[model samples]
Target: MLTVSEKFTAFRIHKDDNNKISSGFEQLSLEQLTAGEVVIKVAYSDINYKDALAATGKGRILRTYPLVGGIDLSGVVIRSEDPRFQSGDKVLVCGAQLSELYDGGYSEFARVKADSVVNLPQGISLRDAMALGTAGYTAALAIQRMEDNGQVPERGPIVVTGATGGVGSFAINMLSNIGYEVIAFTGKTEQAPYLQALGASKLLNRHDIEIGTKPLENAQWGGAIDNVGGETLAWLTRTTHVWGNIASIGLAGGIKLESTVMPFILRGVSLLGINSVEMPLSVRAQGWKRLASDLKPSKLALIAPTTIKFADLPQAFDAYVEGRVTGRTVVEIDASLD
Candidate 1:
């Protein structure tokens, strides 16, 4: 059987007295890991907004200090106490309190709970899984649930808020690939053509509808896959067509929801909450299966990360936080052992 070796470089975050996050490379040992049933020789990890928050200590994403700060990781399993996984099994762990209660995938190695592991389906590379990452998973989950709830191509157009971000971009592509007319919403008007290339039928400026704190407003979109919280969510909830379901996933804008019950009570609209983290293993596997099947975007390979070596993690994390980064940013670890 294979094993995790000694002294793997990890992107470590240390919180100071002021709660400022300071992240850099540090050598870690298996003994430093929190308890789990399996150990992964991390092959790839992509930067997400949440990871940016933890890396920069901007949003209180991590519950613990001095932890590795990555929420999504894909790699080969080296050791396992669980029957479901074995050595050489390619797996992925998203959410599950990594970068919070435990060290995460921004490392050459990681130990994760067996329950959090999802065996990669055929045609999905371990590295591509990181490109899809947590953001892509959540986006796929939203689209899946929406379709499961009777959303279809005839439903005018689907709205995707935060279109330039990871989740929104992937959502647009997935929806488009599956033949849904998608209307992307973003603050970045300059990215309109780029989004269109990913199958956005149209684009909506954020300042136009998502700015106000109105309780409710005009109904516009037939369906929605919303990642931006706060007014954006509220706006989408109000604007969604009757019986339309909007999946609320991320809280990038803000978590506060000050909306009237009119959309739900009057229009029969539904706000489905999406929690990719702590989701049941069966559900996660199902989501992955969906990703492998219908929800896999045609342009997925284009959004693949710009791979950087482990030593560049610190600067990469910083760039990720500063919003200068686009698409996925993958950290490449030593793959020889795998």
Candidate 2:
């Protein structure tokens, strides 16, 4: 158990009087953390595009200044006012508004709201939990939502945009493991082998495919898990087959939707928005349950190949921000806890 008087290392983000964003490691005590019922000895946290944005000031990710900057964490509980958890329980928190509404996981110890914590599901290790992080979790949520909306392998191939990214990688693997033919839509066609290993049946290079200007083009995909928005998403809406579901996960390309409602009305195409945050606890629990069982990525190691020490965290964000990274990078805060 961590004593209240002990100082722990935390990566904190702050905005100054001049409104410039800055972040770095600092020593912090338990009382300095935001309010929460569970105090965890953080074992692992993973890097996401959001984490990069927060740490580098590339995007506005924090609603409060001087907050710790990790959105996903896996750890062991040391103290809990919540009846659902107790000391030594393995747990995780993802997309719970950490770093935005409260101090987050990029610390040796994290105090998180009881509602935000999850008992780490069986069949996945604490390390594996962080390896999945929000990226895999979001991918699971998207797949679950698609299936719930009546999507099946018989519907035809599911096109996963941003296929080289963490979410896309996990989506491809999980979808394929469950017998869905997965088509990877990516700009980096050179990563064909990598995508193929993740169970993509085919690859569609974004640069080569002429995105038709018609309101609805010939339906090419049964459904899609879209990470890129704007033209790519518009293309998905137009090209998806009848009764198909398009899970809109990210807006890496652009947020504007210029397409008409032709697909939704004419073909019964459903556009499901996949927001990892703000999910009900029941939904969150079920998603993690699936992630541990049926939806578990068979190529988990391949998708998240990098694990770095906590001290190396600052140097890792640039690759994510610059879009030079592939797969996820786990930040090992205390591997001994695992």
Candidate 3:
């Protein structure tokens, strides 16, 4: 077994009196971390919206203060007490209380429960897995749930809101790859070309999607993968086809939904809530397996995730909070591993 580091660099968040929050890299010992069965030498971790929120204190992402802040990690096991995983085995972890109830993936090394981990699927690189991260996995889960509700490419265009973010981008690529015409909605009109390149057949300015007084309208979309909830999701609910599925993922816009039951009661629209954070391991594994196969985008390089070193995360977190970054951003935690 590899000797655990006496001290490791981790980006930590601190909340002080008067509710001000500050974050920076700090040295932490192994004993400071929460207990788990597997110890991983983290090769990479990615910045999700929630991570950004936690790091910047913009949202209620953490239940505790002075915590390491990253929700997604990909790495190789350096030490394992569990038989299911051994030293040198590659794995990935997302959600499952990381960055919330537990110290998370921003550190050079992370000790996590083996049950909360998934063996890295064969044929996917550590970098590539981090590229997908939690965003891509959530996108896959959203699509799978929609498909389970009898959604099909033959139905018509699937509308994706918040189309410039990671989940929306991945949803577009995956839906298009599966032969569904994708209609992407975004406020950043400058990203039209980028969205089109990712297989969005049509692009709607965010302003174009307004929640009208009509309880239901002429259905314009067969289904929807929504990242920006609230008004955008409300609009999608009013516009989706009969028996259509609306996979609700993120709440980038706002949390409250102000809509009537007309869409569900009248048109039989199904609003599928996607909670990637607490999903069972079986579903999480299925999502990752599909992410490696049919849902894996050929244009990941085009997505061009902005990669940064672990130390640069404080600035990266600010960028994410300001909505200045696009696609995904993965942090290279251990240069020697890759």
Candidate 4:
């Protein structure tokens, strides 16, 4: 146990009889935190859908209870015994069992295993990393796989479903920055200019790409970054161009996949599963480095979240789950006004 005798607070979820959900902020001793090689003064933690799920108990995102509920965090190392990190160094962590197998980052401080923490590379601030958060990391993983599989910007417009959401918005901006003519797909017609501002050359309504009764539809998209699963995935698989790829990042729409193998066999379309959590630390570092360099958004300053005090997180988190959040939402825990 690495006890530094520091006092802090965190929002924790604890279940009562009948498994009813209740969560609120609680004061914690340094020793109450889970054991880890490094202890950080948490600087930034953004609200993600998974975090909302864990907080609300709407989904089984957290396999454990009585847990702190943040899946990604960026901050400065305050105490460390690991050779790879030392006091005052900045870093960020995403996925890596936070709010799952261990206590997490919705606190004024955190203790994280050194094995899963990635030292933030040059060119990205700790704040920027948390603003990107798990959603952006998942987006980066999907785009990296697409490029690896020979999908190119010149092939055609890359379609990104769920364009108004975090992963979709980040991927759209990143793809457009790399010169891909991006097609943004969304249910909200009001977000057209917003998506276009992120470099989407076109907008497609969700209903336009609804799961058709047919199996194989016209091959339109050269490649895709799909965050919505179920029928949206099926449509993307069947309708993507020959030899193109679709990176499946979420089951937000659903888990059921009802597509045939014709897209895989005839057109040679490929589906790559991207699990940001449980990724090797080396690979996670590489993804973060790439995000810092190429995929980092040019307009992150404009497109990034509006900051809120730690006290406001519960209502904001509830708003997120109720489908009210548009862009990012960062909690200012132990943050300086500067």
Candidate 5:
């Protein structure tokens, strides 16, 4: 049995007085963790683009030093002051300022606000929740918002950019499962079979999407989930069907949006900005419930996901930074903790 006196290991990022940053596993007691209303014995944590940025110091993701480096974690609550949680309650934490303003789930344990944690919905296991992680949650939120904007499968095909990445992959799978004709835009044409198995009906190579010099183009897709911003997003803005919804989620390509208001003013295009980090608890719960039910992929194991141990995190993070990793990666922090 675990005890409070024992030390736990966590992958932490630290900066020296000279401002040089470094990261690795460190031993720490519970008292050293960020104060929270609840404590969790972490079982699984997943890698997202932001997590990689925080871990590698490649992006301005971490606001504090000596911080745990995971934005998504799943575990059993070991202690709680909140009336809603108790010992042995399965819960998952995604974003909510994790790995930024507070300690996160790169450790065998995590301390977080009770309000930031959500009980695992029925039909989704702890591991399964981590498998979906923040990427899947964000994709589901985008879909939900698009549906609210009158996007329907019967209208036309939905396009997903960066289709091989985490959010794009989940968006394609969920949109396809929901009966939409899903077209995937990817740079990896060789991964066509993988994208097809994920339910993408058509595959467009990166070169296929032109950054035309026009304010507007012919309408194609009825809706789009864009993870790759910049030119790709500008292209979608011009070509999306009238009244089409475009959920702008990531800036993997570039943050600068160079597009005219023609698409919005003329076609009634709706561009939604998805920020998962500060999502409200109620909205998070709804997304998880849908993930546990209608949006759950049948062959989630087929994402060709990679599972790594705690010690392998640094290397995994490097792979992600180099653009070598695709799909989801679950970090098994403690097999026994599960």
Candidate 6:
């Protein structure tokens, strides 16, 4: 068992009284972390756009100051007050408000709420869990929700917007694995080969396409897994076929939805809002189960090709915030834990 007195390195974010945000590696003991029922010796963590925002102050991500700055982690339980988990069990925590409401995973150790923790599903390593992280988990959740809402291959080809992004990449691979013809809608047409390798059958170049002004344009897609919001999402609403489900996951393009009620009333289209945070434990468990199984991206390596040491984490956020990163980047805290 790890002792509470032992100090470990953590990438911590702090907001000053002047509201200037700064973050760096600092030594901390277990007693200094937020209240939690489970203690984990973290094996791996991963970068998400939210983590970049929190760490760099590019966007406001944390509700409180001076917390560790990773949003996702996978590790082994060294101690647990929760009856559901025991020592030495491998676990993962994603989208449970890490780095937002509670202290996060950018550390050698993590103290997390029991409800936020999940047993690492079979068939994935600790490294694999963080590689998937919240991005992969959210993609899986969007796909699952779409399927539950009657989305099927027969409905039509699934169009994934923000095609070069982490969620978009995973959605493309998972959708294709299950027999759906996947179309990638992206601004980065130069990355056609990368997207195609992830099972995208066609690439819709966002730059060249004309987004028509009609309330309902020609129905082109059976369904959609949208990561870019704003006009791109508006176009999706206008173009998706009857009874097709559009899983709205991100607001990268813009948050304002400028669309008429005609699509919902005339086409019976469903726009399912996909929020990974604050999900029910059962929902989180079921999502992970599927992620370890059918929804697991076959091109996992291609989707998350980079792994950085924990020491390299401070320098990594700038790429993510600048929108220069493609796919996921896993941070290795302790490879031996895998």
Each prediction's TM-score against the native? 0.93, 0.98, 0.96, 0.95, 0.97, 0.98
Task: For candidate 6, write residues 1-338 as lDDT tens digits.
Answer: 54443899999999999999999999999998999999999999999999999999989999987899899999999999999999999999999999998999999999999999999999999999988999899999999999999999998999999999989999999999999999999989989999999999999989898999999999999999999899999999999999999999999889999999999999999999999996999999999999999998899999999999999999999999998998899999999988
lDDT of 5 by residue, 19-105 (tens): 777899999988888889998999999898888887777887888877988988999888889989988898999968889989999
How does each model score on lDDT? 0.83, 0.94, 0.88, 0.85, 0.88, 0.94
lDDT string, candidate 2, 49-148, tens digits: 9999999999999998899999999999999999999999999999999989899999999999998889999998999999999999999999999999
lDDT tens digits by residue: candidate 4, 1-338: 22344567899988887888788899887678778888888888889888898898887777767888898888888888898998878888898999888889898888899988999889987778888889889988899988999989777889999898999999999999988999988998898888888999999998765667777898899988988899889989889998888989878789999989999999999998988987888989999999999998876765575888788888877787888878887778766511
| Candidate 6, residue 316: lDDT | 94
Residue 228 local lDDT, model 5: 87
Compare candidates 1 and 2 on TM-score and give the better one: 2
TM-score for candidate 5, residues paired by index = 0.97
Residue lDDT tens for model 1, 1-338: 66677887788889888867688788889888777999998888877777877877777877878888788888888889999998899899987789889889988889888999999988788877888988888898887788788888886689998888888889999988888889998889988778898899899887775445555577778889888888778888878888899999877789898889988998888899988886889989999998888888788766764887777766666677778766777767755533
Residue 253, model 1, lDDT: 88
* CA RMSD of each candidate after superposition: 2.0, 1.0, 1.5, 2.1, 1.4, 1.0
Using lDDT as the measure, name the better of candidate 1 and candidate 5. 5
Of candidates 6 and 5, the better by lDDT: 6
* Candidate 2 ranges with C-alpha deviation above 4 Å: 1-5
Q: Count the backbone clashes (under 3 Å) in each candidate.
A: 0, 0, 0, 0, 0, 0
In model 1, which runs have C-alpha deviations exceeding 4 angstroms? 16-20, 210-217, 335-338
Error of 4 at 209 (Å): 3.3
Model 3: per-residue lDDT, tens digit, 309-338?
887778777777888888888889885666
Q: Which residue pairs come into collision in candidate 3?
A: none
